[model samples]
Target: MNLYSIAIQQLTRQHMATIEALVRQQPEFDRVEDLADRLRQAGVRAEARYVPAEKLFIAVYGDIAQVEAALETLCRLNRLNCVPGSSSWQLVHQDHSITQPAVLVIHL
Candidate 1:
């Protein structure tokens, strides 16, 4: 498997619970989830939820070229006017560091 696939595999099993917990804490994330579901209906296995420390993480598996398309669709569905920063990983383990994709991280 490639790096992206490996990263996603690790996250799906280990990080999804934390993500779900964080999502439950935010009302805005409910809308995000709804938008994610729509993306799923369109054949994108996209997952959107919050990681710890209040940062949102979106993971898209399959077709790297389609990743941005998924994100754009998400932005349109949520009516977000700006493109958030993209990141390669989900969670970061650092002290006093905002190194883990602070501005709406999207991964593929």
Candidate 2:
């Protein structure tokens, strides 16, 4: 099987639905909408959620590499930093003074 098929099988074996990412900043409503739109445009199924007083949560469905590349492009354009993990992504501010929160990727 190809990589995508293998990935799907692995996720299925683990009973995982989606891979999630965390953005350290709580962005404005417009920014959140823009993020979701951009991901969709890149052909990745994605959703961004921002609850009041909580960090921004991004859930991506499909190829992880594609999602990460899309995220990196978006972050570069927005002057943010994109850090990717095995099954999660983290978006941080470019400015080093701002500390990034600890990231946890929960598989469900």
RMSD of each: 13.4, 14.9
Q: Which candidate number maximizes TM-score?
A: 2
**Regions more than 4 Å wrong, model 2:** 1-29, 50-55, 96-108
- lDDT per residue for candidate 2 within 1-108, as digits (tens), equals 799999989988665432222332334444656667787888878776655465556667887677777887888886777776778766667888865543322111
Cα TM-score of candidate 1:
0.46
Q: Could you tell me which residue pairs clash in candidate 1?
A: none
| Model 1, span 41-90: residue lDDT tens | 76778788665575565566787556666656655654443344444422
Off by over 4 Å in 1: 1-25, 74-78, 82-105
TM-score, every prediction? 0.46, 0.53
lDDT (Cα atoms) of all candidates against the true structure: 0.57, 0.63
